[model samples]
Target: MGEERRGISRRGLIGGGAALGVGAAAVGFGAGRATAVETERAGAAAAYSLYGAHQPGIVTPVQDRLHFATFDVTTDSRAALVDMLRAWTDAAARMMHGDGAGPSGPTSGDYDAPPDDTGEAIDLPPSRLTLTFGFGASLFDDRFGLSGKRPAALDPLPHFPGDNLRPERSEGDLCVQACADDPQVAVHAIRNLARIGFGTVGMRWSQLGFGKTSTTTRDEATPRNLFGFKDGTMNVKSDDRDALADHVWVGEDADQPWMAGGSYLVARRITMTIETWDRQSLREQERVVGRTKSEGAPLSGGVERDQPDFERAGREGKPLVDPAAHVRIAHPDHNGGVQMLRRGYNFVDGSSDIGRMDAGLFFLAYVVDPATHFVPVQMRLATLDDMQEYVQHTGSGLFAIPPGVRRGEYVGQGLFSA
Candidate 1:
């Protein structure tokens, strides 16, 4: 798509006009070649393709906003569940293309029947919206005759040392991750998908996130987490195709063939103790995160992009980067060089019962296998990281994100086929 095509305005999309369509042809022209209306239209139409080898949301550029929801399968009938997946797939495809969720769209002359779309995003652009769906381990229960089809790698995550998990917000049978530059666009996608699966599935828990916490591509600058520390400095960028294939995408020889190009998603709701962290000295804070607050550089010395010198010595002959520092414990070198793609967001939910702010990072990671990639890494952090004292893991989930859908096929079609 041209730069002009990505700039189409919401008004231009809702009210079809020649000015908006003509703007795309004005590229490389001099002054006054395109009207102001045309310019607005060209700027507002950014979108991501929904059909691909893998889901768009996994490796797509991280969006500014997120609406992630998990659902429980309410019906025991396999046909009903399959039908709902198909319906959801269709609606997702339409919504991602900047179209309404259903055939009738935002409006219809037939007043007696309810409109198919929720009408909240009628005039908005797609904003690079991407809706990713995944199946939880619980979905493979005998309820849908999928007991034997469950990928062995989809097993439930083992409980860690510092987890204060709440049962209500933990796991679900399915998950939908909607991300977009426009908050309304992301919310609308999830709301409509839930509406489409009304009778067959019920929402378990959901999270709304803002201010992305990491960068998935090399061109973008790294973002900070709620703790005011730059996160994912060594993250596997989407541009590194080889790294993505080895660390994120599942191979055909995986436990299940249906998950060939798919990946595993691990979501953790980590609540930060902002009050306690704020009271600490700047030096203490830097020690905990193991990076300079101003430059986000390693304590061992060097620029932000330089590799940390873990063996460097300090004033008292102690390691410059403490062994218990958050960065040190979570570093790939400390672990087996195993890394996952981190696409998280900073969240601030009003307050707790005692009046303290309920805010932290909603950690989301995509990996080839959680068993080898996520489990051991988290295990080390849970026991050794000093940052754990100021944060608590309150909710968690794991899902097997299936491969992308074709034009005519539905999500998870491979599992249902003979």
Candidate 2:
């Protein structure tokens, strides 16, 4: 954290970081003692390009782990903030390729000073690591003279029926979503970034997630949530270009030109009442989810991928998929044909105050506009979905994701220059 005492000017450090990041892209290390010691781990890691039409984490195949962090801008200087972002982007590009945070390597850095890289991920593969960044509503404030550049779609999310959101766990000026197959890889990405941002930014809150709750690729089997029902079975997939265009990516028509090709992100930390939910009968659970407990078929009868037939009736002439069921209430058909590209993960943060499991879904979704794709669907779910009783929206954030960056350009370059 004492980056200043490292006997180097901050600007020089940032410049060197960027130069080393670019050069490290094609660098590879030979098998060493660490690899021999950790031979049990995964072999080679799959690396994704850090530069593209859109950020990697949003539509990239959902990873097994996530380390999502939101940060507050501590410095009022726009130059300082920009420099920190450039440093972050450089480090992220290098790390995604499984390289050290700095070219000097973690342990090889100057012995007299703290290491440039954290060294925890030294022996790890990239594991398809991705670092996606975004700007929260608060980041558009007068501090950096960015008020006019604020996108209308970045407006604060409205409160829903039963939200018990905690202030400490809520919004921030910026967010960085790191995901990788290895938990250590994801954790190391955030830790190094936080270290790099030292004085310019302060981490407001962070969430560690394991066991992905949604699938962005159709080939992977659908995953179940803590409630034991298939979550995001009908999620928008990376191959569905039409759906991504219609519901996820911001296009040229966006009110803010700088946001074109970008997307809006909504994160909800839903805490489930694990004990109470576990007590519910099998039939009750099935009814709440509108899907069979075993195969995840719609209550109306079909395989996991079968669309829910809302009009189907049961023996008593009542709808087979309950009118208030989560699947029914939050379906695209019911939400003005809107859908979200969800990439959430399950998390168990030890125990609660009363000794119950402190676990739930860390719900993350990408949409073109939350106004059309998220708010209304969530409103219906909050008010009518039977699953509402078992889960509480405890933490929330809305961020404006910038388009992918080009080499020599930092993330969010458009917003600052526009």
Candidate 3:
């Protein structure tokens, strides 16, 4: 029931500003325009939010992990809304309260059973695991009764590959994404997904919000989708301000103690198979991610975050991307360390009883150390990359987002009661 704490803080919009809000009102918010009147006002303004590197906790909040709650459940009684979504995908104190484990169940730090009204139990709010899910509209649509009536296929977000949009717009009506490792259990799991109805029932409306990032590993394309090459060409390029503080802010002297007004640490996961990935051959999926099925570039070129030159694409030492590629294990450089920061989102949900599912990405990032920046590029994509054989990390979590809570305080004030 505690909704108005407004927004901002994936380390202050990764240091510049696009999503995360109290309505910053830039509306076409930078990216893809150095100018031409900011590319004719970024086309006209609006369309960048597919959720940019989310965070429900900046870097402190966990009894254990995996906390993401996105909803909008309305059940005048579609048989109590499909038994509340099959008791929210097969219950156990609604996933995680019983400590969810996997078989599609098991991951719960306990969060004080029966819809945590700030109960803080069930454990989770540390580095990050599975709870990854995505669904949009069509609760069988008849508005909500589930039969043969379609109207909830809502998803119009597509324009985040170094975006330069603007043809005139400014959206908001539906968008719910919450990631948590503990910013008070990411606001008690988005207010227990709006008290079990799934969230914002009657609608006070306004959803559009993205977040912090940094990714490249877990394969099948960045651990199951949400922008790990959904046209990946080395993302996050704030152009200047140190690439806008490395894709949007978080360095005022990052030492840690829970860093106060936090910034960094926002890992993610979501892999649903993507048209069974059309079983390879786009040149074996561009030689398992070295780049280019007509432009993801790199095999040592000046695209996708450039600087690539891997001794000019292997320098005849036999490497035009294949020493376990995924862009040479996510940029090995041969010199200048590795780098990350790619805010994200891209999802798909299928009507259940086990029918359609097509999935991938809602992933995120923002770092300082996930063991020297996201576990050595996800331990070379889970041991010797190759897009880790068509991907599968399946939903996970970790949040610690606490920064921007001034107007009389309360948005994890002191990172959720310390």
- All candidates' TM-scores? 0.91, 0.90, 0.33
**Best candidate (score: TM-score):** 1
Query: Candidate 1 on 251-334: residue-level lDDT in tens?
Result: 989878899989999999999999999999999999999898878899999988788899999989999998899889988898
Tens digit per residue, CA lDDT, model 2, 77-143: 9999999999999998888867778766665546767778888876666787888999999999899
Which segments of candidate 3 are over 4 A away from where they belong? 1-177, 181-188, 196-246, 250-273, 276-278, 281-283, 291-307, 310-340, 343-356, 363-403, 406-408, 411-418
- Score candidate 2 by TM-score against the native: 0.90
The total of clashing pairs for model 2 equals 0
Location of the lowest summed lDDT over 10 successive residues in candidate 1:
29-38
List the global CA lDDT of all models.
0.84, 0.85, 0.37
Clashes of 1: 9
lDDT tens digits, residues 1-418, model 3? 1223333222132224332233434323233322111111121121121111222222111112233443344445545544543343332123222222112211222333332232342333111211222223322235543233211112223322222222221222212344333444434444444454443242222112223222322222322233234343454433433533443334445443333333443334445355545655676676677776554666655554455454444546775666776667666353136455555544454444656454545455554434455555665566776665555554433333323333233222232233
Sorting all predicted structures by TM-score, with the top scorer first, yields 1, 2, 3
Question: What is the model-wide C-alpha lDDT for candidate 3?
Answer: 0.37
Q: Can you give the lDDT of residue 309 in candidate 2?
A: 96
Cα shift from native, residue 249, model 3 (Å):
3.2
